[model samples]
Target: MRVAALDDDVEELDLIKSTLRAIGHDCHVFTEGAALQRELRRETFDLLIFDWHLPDTTRPEIVQWVRNHLQARIPILFVTNRRQERDLVEGLAAGADDFMMKPIRVGELAARAIGNLLGNALKFSREGAWITCAVEALGVDWPVRVEDEGPGIDEALQAQLFEPCVRGRSGTQVDGAGLGLAFVRTVAQRHGGKVLLDSAPGRGSAFRLVLAQAPDAPPPERGQGEAPA
Candidate 1:
C-alpha cells in the first residue's frame, strides 16, 4: 500500500518509514502538515497516518480538509500520545478510522495499516505480493495478461467491471474513481481488441487484453538480375 505519514519528530517519522517499508508498504513522510497537504494535492495514497499535534496544523483541520475540500475516502489512521477518552472521540469525529498511541509496535502498526487498505490478502498475502504480466500468441492475435493473487472480484461484479463509475460492493471502501477498467476497455476496443476476466472467488484474477496482430509486411522487391549478397 502507498501511505503518507505526517509527524514533526524526525526520529518517529524515520521509524514509521522503516517499519512500513519492512512490511512491503511504501511510505512518504512529512515533517509539517503543509508539506503533507501539498503532496495530497499532487498524489493519491491508500492510507494517511498523522500525528495529532502537527506544527502547522491540527488533526481536526487536516481531517476537515480531507473530508470537505478533497472529498477523498482515503482511510486515515492517527498516531499520537492523546489517550484521553475525549481525545479519542474527537479524533473519530474528525474522520479518523483508527488511532494508535505513541511508542508504536511495528507489527501492530503494519497490521492496522494493511487492514485499513483491504482485509485479508492485503494484510496476509502468502504469495508475497507479486503481479505478472505477459503477452502470448492467441491464434492470429496477441493477448496481454496481467495476473494477481489478491482476492478475486465477485462474479456478479465482473459483468459491470468495465463500466464507468461502477465499483464492486467489496471494493466500495477502496479509494478509486472506478475508471481504470473503463479506460482499459476503451483502449482495447480502439485497437480492435477486447478485454476478458477469468476469476472466481478466492481463486485470484487474470485480465487478458487481446489485440489483433498487424499483417506481416510484404518482402522487399529485388531487381531481376540482382545477385545474393
Candidate 2:
C-alpha cells in the first residue's frame, strides 16, 4: 500500500518510512502539513499518518480539509506523543481512523477504520448546496452536527440507515460500500453516545453525534475560545 507520513521530527519520519519500506510498502514523507496538502491535490495514497501537532496547521483542520476536498474514504492514523484520553477522543472526532502514541513500534501501524459523514454529504448534495458543521455543548454532552441541503432521506430508509451495508435509494447513485453510517454509529456507541438522523423527503438531512463529556473534563467557558469543530 502507498502511505504518506507527516511529522516534523526527521528521525521519526525516517523510522516510519524505513519500517513501511521494510514491510514492502511505499512511503512518502513530509515535514510540514502544507507540503503534504499540496501533494495530496495531485497524488493519491492508500493511507495517511499524521502527527497531532504540526507547524503550519492543526490535525483537525487538515483532516477536515482532506475529507471535504479530496472526498476520498482513505484511512488516516495519528502517531503522536499526546497520550491524553481527551486527545484521542478529539483526534478520532476529527475523522482519523486510529490514534497511536509515539516511541514508534514497527507492527503498531496496522489498523483501519474511517469516518465519511462529511464526504457523504458532499457527494449526495447538489452542486453549490449548503453544508454546515457545528459543535456545541449541550449540558454534559457535546453535540456535533452536520447539516446539508440535499435530497432528504426517506423515513423507511432511515430506519436501517446505520446498519452495515444498508443504503438509501439516493445512495445507489453514489460510490461507497454503505459502511459510513455504520462506522459513525460504532464510534458514537464506543464513546458512550449515540448518533441520530433527522430528515424527510425534500427537506434535507441532519446528523447529530452526541458524545458524553468526561466527568473530569473542564466545563466550556461561555465566550473564551472557539468551539471544537
RMSD of 1: 18.2
Q: Model 2, which residues run further than 4 Å from truth? A: 1-115, 169-172, 219-229
RMSD of 2: 11.7
Off-target runs (Cα >4 Å) in candidate 1 are 105-229
lDDT of 1 by residue, 94-125 (tens): 88987888876433433342232233233223
**Model 2, CA-based lDDT:** 0.74
> Which lDDT tens digits does candidate 2 get at residues 150-205?
78898989999987567664443776556567657755665678889899878788
lDDT of 1: 0.67
**Pairs of colliding residues, candidate 2:** none
Q: lDDT per prediction?
A: 0.67, 0.74
Clashing residue pairs in candidate 1 (N, C-alpha, C atoms within 3 angstroms)? none
Q: Could you tell me every candidate's TM-score relative to the true structure?
A: 0.50, 0.48
Whose lDDT is greatest here?
Answer: 2
